[model samples]
Target: MELPVVHYSKSEYIETDTGNKVSRKSVICGSQNIVLGGKTILQTGSVIRGDLKRSGASNFVVVSAGRYCFLSQSCIIRPPCKAHKGAFNYFPVKIGDYVFIGESSIVQAAQIGSCVSIGKNCVIGKFTIIKDCVRIEDNTVIPPNSIIPPFSVYRGSPGKMVDELPESIREIYEARCKDRYTKFVPSVDA
Candidate 1:
């Protein structure tokens, strides 16, 4: 199908139960079932797609922004599926409030919690639970079904818990979320 062209620039608030946001310079194909909350920024060169409707289930991608969330440049979020047919017949990706997904990352069948920071070029695997206040560094890969505890720093390939972040850093993270809420503006077109 030839999808309609959609573009957003200059920071507008958009809220929709199901739609795709294609940047003027980017493409988002087959993400018709995705839900983007108000003030969520879908930056340049990002592509988010899912086959939820094709597979006969509720495979929509949900991005809930309590205040604000940013899906940075060149990121891909798709449903988790295996090479074989019907492998990923059932799995969806869910991201929560105040999440910052950095550039060039692929997240599949993952549940990311509030206040999470996923660094650039990271690959979050299927069925993983990334809890709140977690900082995943750049170029890391999180294996499938791993439960990352809250308030931790995970790094390296196949990502391990490096350590508990300092309390001060936690405070800073909390403060950042607060700042986002304070500065958030619901999209005018919402």
Candidate 2:
């Protein structure tokens, strides 16, 4: 049996030669400051706020995602902010390779390590650091400045560790992320 269509046609998303596909409908401010590694997918209606940079004279990246990463539809990926010594500034969001951010999630995270999977509608508060091989369940709310250790699953409103991921799942996660990138194609007909 053939697989049903999910993602919009490849045409709707601007596919770079390196396989980075960004939806036309997505709102990306300060495109120059955003760094996307090859084969990254930014789905429709996602908002990447690269415009919110740190307060300084030097040029700093606001949002940087590694290769084979996926940001789902309507998600908001913005830099985290905080007040330091009476001055407030936005910190960069660093996402490692093979990361998957679910739909409608608002991420104001400091770092998301490789093989991390975040479910839909979650709100990741500022300065949240998600370590490698972590899974966050849908609708979860992570408190600010929280650090998720590796190989764990966090769920619930005040996101708590529910379980640990098996070491075997690392390869599986990598394969799934890579597969999704390869299978995303534009629909022949609307």
Candidate 3:
């Protein structure tokens, strides 16, 4: 699916050499622990909390996103935390290519596979695992530790598998992600 072209203020975003466009208003903590593959877009007011790492002295990624990932406005992406040995420990968040998280979504999932489209105002609970080619509808709330299978559609609070996706869903999501990335441009008047 092709998305409409959206113009943004040139001064508000920074486009990197690897084709990653990050908004200046986005709050990304612990930059060293955050890895973004090429052609990823982090829109304004998005927050990536890479600062919360596991309770240990290991230098590793807290949030690793693949190519062409899109995090919409005001979205919060954080590492999932759990209590282990009477202490809190943060785990990594792995997002694959062509994943689109809609506006105002809070995602604390452990893993989100390729070609996943998450709609607006959703809450993906901590430790949730979403496999490839999945579509989560708007305002959905996935429970913690839930594993969403591949080629499925989930909706509503305590999101459940409402339908199965077509085999071509991966291709469709990949194209959509590419189209959105290409269409996101700086306004000429800016």
Give per-residue CA lDDT, model 3, range 1-190, as digits (tens): 3479999999999999999999999999999999999999999999999999987746889999999999999999999999988998999999999999999999999999999999999999999999999999999999999999999999999898899999999889989999999999999981
Better of 2 and 3 by TM-score: 3
* Clashes per candidate (backbone, < 3 Å): 1, 3, 0
Predict model 3's lDDT versus the native.
0.96
Q: How do the residues 1-190 of candidate 2 rate in per-residue lDDT, one tens digit apiece?
A: 2333365675678888888999999999989889999999898899999999888735677899999998999999999987889998888999999999999999999999999999999999999999999999999999999999999999999999999999987897888888888777777784
Per-model lDDT:
0.67, 0.91, 0.96
> Clashing residue pairs in candidate 3, if any?
none
Residues 93-125 of candidate 1 have per-residue lDDT tens digits of: 677767778899988746888778889999998
Q: What lDDT, from 0 to 1, does candidate 1 have?
A: 0.67
Give residue 93's lDDT in candidate 3 (0 to 100).
99
Q: For this target, which candidate reaches the highest lDDT against the unseen true structure?
A: 3
Off by over 4 Å in 3: none
Which pairs clash inside model 1?
Answer: 13-187
